[model samples]
Target: MGKLVDGIWQQAGYDTDNNEGRFVRWDSSFRDSVETDPDARYPAEPGRYRLYVSLACPWAHRTLIVRALKGLEEAIPVSIVDPYMGEQGWSFSDGRDCIPDPLFGARHLHELYVRAKPDYSGRVTVPVLWDRRHGSIVNNESADLLRMLNRAFDAYANRDLHDLYPAERREQIDAVNARVYDQVNNGVYKAGFASTQAAYDEAVGELFCALDWLETHLKGRDWLVGEQLSEADIRLFTTLIRFDAVYHGHFKCNLRRIKDYARLEAYLERLYAIPQIGSTVNFRHIKQHYYSSHRQINPSGIVPAGPILPFL
Candidate 1:
């Protein structure tokens, strides 16, 4: 929740009040690439890059889903941070399904950020693409990493895997992604982390509006765009999965649950049923992180045990 100021870790955690009651996410600092082109600074190569992620994070979860779906587990290895992010921020403490940093043996995620850029000033985020040889981050933006994983490793991925973002349907996919990103994906955060009632109401209104549209659009369709599962679906899937678990209660986005929309709930189950999709989900980590990390929302730090997921 905390961020580094000129490579120095600051304990001043998530500042929602600074945005005038709006929860605006900080822009990702590292935006390099690992393309397939041979002349690229970070060429797509097996074993050259590793991912540092938190399973609790939806952004990071999307990248993991792409990795698993593409069957690139052998190509790119991952190191997971401890789910419970505290004042020190994301750490490498041993926990269920957590993989500690063996590359630099760093205790904190910010240490790795400082290691890459000595004077980096931004929130040290998860789903970090680390270049082993360059000894720096290739990219930290989850959306960027999602596209990178979708196609950059085609030569190394499983033969049975299909392209999530087909060239012909990219326009449609991007269009769908734009609306979903604003009103659905990041919208819940706006509602949950809002400091003012107006902000909360506005965000929640847009969120449910977007959900209503999706419920109507997906009436006779199998995916978000085109005839196949595209990147649009992956982007929204991460957010939808966490809606009831945390957003509904903790984030104050309780107007209507995902379960309230029959299509969305069924669509969620259909996506979850996909091979390797369920493996990417760690409900314990997901639930614990939100209910515990955001002290501003749930000060008591008491996590609920019910409102159970039907699919699980």
Candidate 2:
């Protein structure tokens, strides 16, 4: 949980004390795009982009699911970072199932950020879409990457599936996503990482409120916005999947588990049944990362072995 300062990696803890004991996530720095238009600087092309991700990260996991769903596995390659992000941040491990950066063979993930921008100063996050041809980061924001992967490479995608963000449902999907992102997705972090009781209380209250609303809303519906699954479902699914396993205990967001919500539990099970979606989840990495990485939250670094997810 460190950052890069002027191309140099710094092993430092988060400074929540300054923000009135509230966890404020830093905005993603890279925001470039890979449009499908021929005039675009980053035109859609197979084998032109690479994804750097961490299985433990929900944001990064979004891209992985999108890539698989869109059949971009052969089009765009991926390199996964180690789950336990220590003082130096995400690192590459020399083990099976982990792909090394063939482009630079860098040990640390920050090295790629520095390679992209030597003066870069920010949190080195995952789901970085690197432009192999330009040797620079195309985008580090997960939402942006998800959209890009959805349609940018349609010409080369294995199948043609539109409407992940359909024009007619855009308004509803956007609205649902905004609230879910604030009160649920990011809300869990706010509650878990809150340094003050006031902050934690406010965050946890909001989180459960959103959950209650969702439980009622999804009682008979299959998806969040439209009649079909969209980006909103994908966005919410990542957080809900991890709620009971890690966030409930590690983050102190234990008001009620996702399993406690009948509707949400069924919803989660339905989404988890999706072939590509279920494969993206790595419980071992997810549990190990949170319990072991945040030393301040869990000083003992003792990983728990209970609350087994029945769906998984």
Candidate 3:
């Protein structure tokens, strides 16, 4: 909910006052990559990097799916933060699936940011790629983290998957990902967190427009970009997976549900059927975080029941 400014942690709430009360997400700051080079400062080595994530976050969930699909579970260890983010932001808990920071033994995730750069100033988000060898964060952006894991550690990966960003497919993949991110992925957030009616209406309109486009586009296509699965599909899946359960009612993105879209719903099931993808989703975590953390949206802090998603 806060960001580090000039390498200093500043406690500030979401800035919805700008753009006529619309919530504009800030771009992630940490964007370094860990390539495969023996002499590099942070090489692609097994057990050298750890992922810090929150199960509730769709962005962080992207890395989790990639980690599972690529069979990098053993290669890169992960630590799950508590579902509910407090004023201090994401914190570690003794709950199941939540792992304490093995590298720094820190209680709060902000501590990791401070350790990485004492003067670090940015929104502390997840899935952070922590470099244990260098004792700093390699990257915190989920899009960058997913690509890094897709091929960066191929030497230690169980499967030798080809380039997800294939030469011929890069253009299409990029285009689709951009549309989805703006309309569906981040769109729900804009609508839910908007402080004015105009902002909410604009965002909701764009969201359904994009969803309608996808519903038609996916009529015969199995994947978003290529004939085979790609990162674009993974990006879309995380948001769609949460749409009906959390986004629909909790976030007030109720124009239509993912379940209402035949192609999108089936597409979700197809991805869920993938060997390890389903295991990465935690509905309980996803629900707890959004309902509890965003107190401004739901002041009572009461988590809802009954929207029994088939996936769960």
> What TM-score does prediction 3 earn?
0.97
lDDT of model 1, residue 113: 95
Query: Which residue segments of model 2 deviate by more than 4 Å?
Result: none
> How many angstroms is residue 300 displaced in model 3 relative to the true structure, after the best TM-score fit?
1.0
Residues 1-312 of candidate 1 have per-residue lDDT tens digits of 678889999877556677778889789988888889978999999999999999999999999999999999999999998889898899997888899998989999999999999999889899899999899998999999998998898889975678888889989988999999999999999998888888888899999999999999998988988788888988999999999998999998888999999999999999999877888999889998999888888998888996888998
TM-score of each: 0.98, 0.98, 0.97
On TM-score, the stronger of 1 and 3 is: 1
In candidate 1, clashing pairs total: 0
At residue 79, give the lDDT of candidate 3. Answer: 95
lDDT string, candidate 2, 73-147, tens digits: 999999988888887889898654577788899998999999999999999999899998889999999999889
Candidate 3 regions exceeding 4 Å error are 5-10, 160-162
Worst 10 residues of 2 by lDDT: 93-102
**Tens-place lDDT digits, model 3, residues 48-152:** 899999999999999998888788999999999999898778999898778887776788899999888888777888989998888899998998988888888
Model 3 residue 61 CA deviation in Å: 0.5
For lDDT, the strongest prediction is: 1
Clash count, predicted structure 3: 7
